[model samples]
Target: MGPSRHDQLTIGELSARSGLATSALRYYEELGLIHSERTAGGQRRFARQALRRVAFVRAAQRVGLSLEEAGAALAGLPVDRSPTATEWSRVARTWQSRIDEQIADLERLRDHLTGCIGCGCLSLGTCALYNPHDIQGTDGPGARKLLPRHSRTA
Candidate 1:
C-alpha cells in the first residue's frame, strides 16, 4: 500500500481538511504559524498534528486575532509534535484576557451610546462624546485599545 493518509498530508489535503484555503494556509506558513518538511522534489509534507494547529488558527482568527498574534501563539506549541495541555492552556489564558478586555470595552460603549447617541450632537465637534476621531477607550497597543484583540503587525 501507499503511505498512510494521516502519516503526512500534502498542502492541499491540509487546506481541505482544515477548511482553510490554500492561500491562507500558505500565508500562515509564511507568518511562522505552521511548519512543513519538504519532499525531495520540493513538495511540502505536514504531520497530522497540523490539523489541530490549523483548527486552532481558524478559531483564533474568528475571535479577531491577527495573523501575527495567532502565529505567535501557535509558535509556542512544539513544532515536532502535537501541543501539550500546558501549551494549550497558556494560549487559552492569553485569549481569555483578550476576550475580557473586549467585553469591558463593549459594555462601556453600550452605556455611552445609550446615554448620548441620539442627543442631536452627532455633528457637534465640541461634544465630549461625539467627535468621530475621539474614540472612548484606551488608546494604545493591545486589547485595551482596540475592539478586537488583533496584533498591530497583521
Candidate 2:
C-alpha cells in the first residue's frame, strides 16, 4: 500500500515532490539544511514537514542567500512542525538587510556595466579611465566598485 499523508517520505519521494535531485537532498541533509531519519535498513526517511523546509531553502536561495545563510534562517523555524505565519514573518524580517544589499549591488552593476566591467582587469581602455592604473586593486581583491559599499575596503 502507498504511504499515507502523514507518513515519512523516502529520499526519492522527497526529491520528486521538491523538484530537487536526491543528490541535492543528500547534500542539504549533510549541510543541516534539512534532516532525515534512518530506517532500520539505513535508508533515509523525511518528515512531511521537510517539504516546507525545502521550499524555505529554495526561497532563501532565490533571494541570493548562501546555503549557510539559509540554514541559519531555517534554524529559527520549528523542527517539528511548519512555521506559523508570525514565525515565518520574524525570520523573513532578518533577511531585509541582506536583500537590500543585493539590490544595491545589482544597481551598482547595472549603473557601471556601460562604463566599467569592474574586475580591475584593466583590459578595457575605459577601465584605465575609471580605475586609473588599477588603483582599485589596492582596495582589495575582486571587482571593488561592484561590491556593496560597506563590503569595500577603505
Scored by lDDT, the top model is 2
Q: What is the lDDT for 92 in model 2?
A: 80
TM-score list, all predictions:
0.71, 0.74
Candidate no. 1 TM-score: 0.71
**Residues 1-154 of candidate 1: C-alpha lDDT, one tens digit per residue:** 9557569989999988988898888887887777888888999888888888888888887767987888878778777677778888988888998888879877877776676666744323333344324545334443233332332321
Q: Candidate 1: what lDDT?
A: 0.72
- Residue-level lDDT of model 2, residues 1-154, one tens digit each, is 8556468999999999999999999999999988888878999999888998999999999888999989989998899887899998898887777799989877765666555554644432234333443543455444445444343232
- The 0-to-1 C-alpha lDDT of every candidate, in the order given, reads 0.72, 0.78
RMSD (Cα, Å) of model 2: 7.1
Off by over 4 Å in 2: 1-6, 117-135, 138-154
Candidate 2 residue 11 C-alpha distance from true site, Å: 0.1
